[model samples]
Target: MRFSAGFSRAAAIAGLVGFGVLIWAAVISPARDWATSNKVALQTSRVEAARLDASIQRLEQEKAALGIETEFSDIWQARQIGEATAKVQAELGEIARAEGISLRSIAPLQSPDIPFAQAVAFRVEAEATLDRVVALTSAVEFHSPVLIIDRASLRRLTRPGRISPQPTLLMQLEIMAPVFIGEGEP
Candidate 1:
């Protein structure tokens, strides 16, 4: 009878210990895991927010450098439709001469009036070294009345003289200039 009682007490103590271990595994371990995951998520969110802030700052700097704010304030600088074609031709000729690009031909195409503006189309054919052609196009882009290139095609020109081994490029460009209807010539 004494052995039986001792056995019963030992079994009860063992059962209590097993129950404690089960509780620790089921509840405490899961709570710790949840907290750790939440910490990781919060850190990820902070990193993403920092990246977005940096992107916004970069975009703002680009806007400022473009002078967009000042460009739009008081007046539109593009020429009126009536004066744009002639002015654009003159400007393009001057740029071609300065950039050392051979001007083959430049002719203004007749286009219908666009809303509140005239769309003046011009076709330019020129031949030069690739570098000189690039320079000419860049100069045209920075010109006051904005010139938009609609179509461009480049072909390798047959070398006429043994001046240089570098292949020359013949560039055909179609450009569009938006001339506001009511604006005056500058």
Candidate 2:
């Protein structure tokens, strides 16, 4: 249809006003509520971000010290008190045999697996020269696998009647190492 310029101008103005009212009703009014919702959401996100940042900082600090603390915690599960004791004795025997030292006995001591620290001890009796005793201690110190010796003592024993009495050496020792839970374990 064809219209006059004056009427078309009035119709266009009316249409514009109607469009503005619709825009204000649908968008502007709801935008206020949305601004409130967004404020709450933003606050929640900031709290979560702060928490995550704190956690990351803590983990990074631990990682810097030990390289990887949580990953190595599994060592506790792999450690066995009895197994470690046997390994110590067996290794001592091997070293003693190689050094021509005779192993007489081992008085195994108490082992208690506490959460932060654990300990195992053995009182070993052997007969060897002073040099051999030192060598055994060095070997155990350097060559032991997943084991540690907290203390060791060597004593020289005297023979009563022998013309040339070779010295009998004895050792008292303590060992400590990490203990952990196995995979998929509590």
* lDDT top scorer: 1
Model 1, 1-186: lDDT tens digits are: 899999999999999989888988999899999999999999999999999999999999987877654342122235555565776778778888999886999988876455445577889998888888888888877766677777899998886555765668889988777665454444
Best by TM-score: 1
Assess candidate 1 and give its lDDT: 0.77
Model 2 clashing residue pairs (backbone): 76-179, 76-180, 77-180
Minimal lDDT window, size 10, model 2: 177-186
C-alpha lDDT of all candidate models, in order: 0.77, 0.66
Candidate 2: where are CA atoms >4 Å away? Answer: 1-63, 67-81, 112-119, 160-168, 177-186
